[model samples]
Target: MIPIRAYVAADFAGVAELWRAVFPDDPPYSRAEVAIPAKLAVQPQYLLIATDGERVVGTASGGYDGTRGWLYAVAVAASHRRQGLGARLVQAVEARLAAAGCGKINLQVRAGNADVTGFYESLGYCVEPRVSMGKRLGVNAGGTGTSGP
Candidate 1:
């Protein structure tokens, strides 16, 4: 079994590379090195990584907004998929959130990504009757400051 542990500053590059491999279509924020450290400064414990020896194989980022817990950027290297690493990452983050007094956890998967949706479903996540929305507060890697659902 791979070992899952709290993310350290040195793990950023490895994690970012893994994210790019697993989420080629991810938004710019997902690959932002600056934003990542900013998040780590807030709740470092919520960011977790799984490694094989010295190599990072998976990652999961989580947060608590007092009322609820949120999970994002849960990714496993393509070469490491189907080996339960993703589930382990989720479990690790869930434990962290739960210990932080969060009562419920929420996550979002892009619509039409059935494979991803099914993966989460297999891990006990269910689709909610709600629409996912977002607002871009500033320019992203694409250099556009648009906001919408």
Candidate 2:
């Protein structure tokens, strides 16, 4: 059985590879080699990974800033897809956020990604009628720019 657990430093390589495979078009900040470790440094418990023995098959990150919670970088390995691992990862994040006293949780799905949007909907997330905007900060790993929104 696949086990879901908090992400450790050793999981970075596997998680980064998984991110590249799952979100090929994601911005540089989202796919950077330092991203996972950076996030873990802030809130290690919020970064969760699912493993089939030693192999990393899924990952999710959650954050709470008092009033609101956010979910990010949720992915399940292609070989592990359709087995509910994605949902499990999401739930794990949600539970963490809720325990942190977060009232509302939000996430963004790329506009053209219908499958991903539907997956979130199935988990009780609804699209809010609001404009999403972003601004880049420093240099990104790919030398493009930072990613937000």
Candidate 3:
């Protein structure tokens, strides 16, 4: 059986590898880039991972802005997909957010990715039919740069 736990500093490599496997369009995030920064920026209580021993098979990150929490970065390993790993990761993240007193959990999957949106919907996320627009400001949240493989 797979197990869920808090993300450790060393688990970044596995997380990055999983990210690479799941998102083929974009380059994978380097462990060195997302590990320490995510550990420092992401709340320890919100970063949940699923593993078989030291290998991270799945991961999900939750972010809270006091009122609501954004559940993002949910990914499962190539070999581990369709084994409920994705749903488990989401449930774990949701539990953590609920424990932290978050009123609502929000997530946005691409419209073109009907499969992904359906998965989220099956897990109780409703369609937020609104114009979700964005702009690149600089580095950090605004940068046009994406996580490299």
Candidate 4:
């Protein structure tokens, strides 16, 4: 059975693996890497993992700007693609954000990624021409995600 849970210390490696499988071109980072770890530790509640019994195959990281919710690092393993794992992870993250009093969720997709853009649109997200402009909270955001990456 597929289970989604809060990111635990033991699941770090699996999460990193999932990230690589989803975005092989990007450099992967260790969970204990100081930068990302510090940021995530402060808001562990916002990081989520999807697993088939301890094997994390999907991940979603959310950032809140004190009002709206921003989603990032959401990726499902290639082997698990198209089985609704991506959508499921987003739903789980958004649910938590809603409960935390976030007004709206915002994300960015690179103009080149048509397939990924379609995925977000199907989930009730519309394209906003505005570019993502923000100072990193000194966090370990693997890449920019205006919507889902």
Q: Taking the tens digit of each residue's C-alpha lDDT, what string does model 3 give over 41-111? A: 75777788899888888888888889889887788887888889899999988888888889899887765
* Cα-based lDDT for every prediction: 0.83, 0.85, 0.76, 0.76
lDDT of 1 by residue, 20-61 (tens): 788776655656475587787888789899998888999999
Give each model a TM-score. 0.90, 0.91, 0.83, 0.81
Candidate 4 residue pairs in backbone clash:
107-146, 107-147, 108-146, 108-147
Task: Give every collision pair in model 3.
Answer: 28-148, 28-149
Error of 2 at 110 (Å): 0.5
Best by lDDT: 2
Question: What does the lDDT come to for candidate 4?
Answer: 0.76
**Which runs in model 3 stand beyond 4 Å of their true positions?**
27-32, 140-149
Mark the 10 consecutive residues where model 2 has the least summed lDDT: 140-149
Candidates in descending TM-score order? 2, 1, 3, 4
Go through the candidates in order and give the clash count of each.
Answer: 0, 0, 2, 4
lDDT of 2 by residue, 94-142 (tens): 9889988988998989888899999999999999998988766555523
Better of 2 and 4 by lDDT: 2
lDDT of 4 by residue, 1-149 (tens): 57888887888788766766666555333232432585476677888889887678888888777878988788888878899989999999999898888989988776699999999998999997786664433344546541122
Candidate 2: how large is its RMSD? 2.1
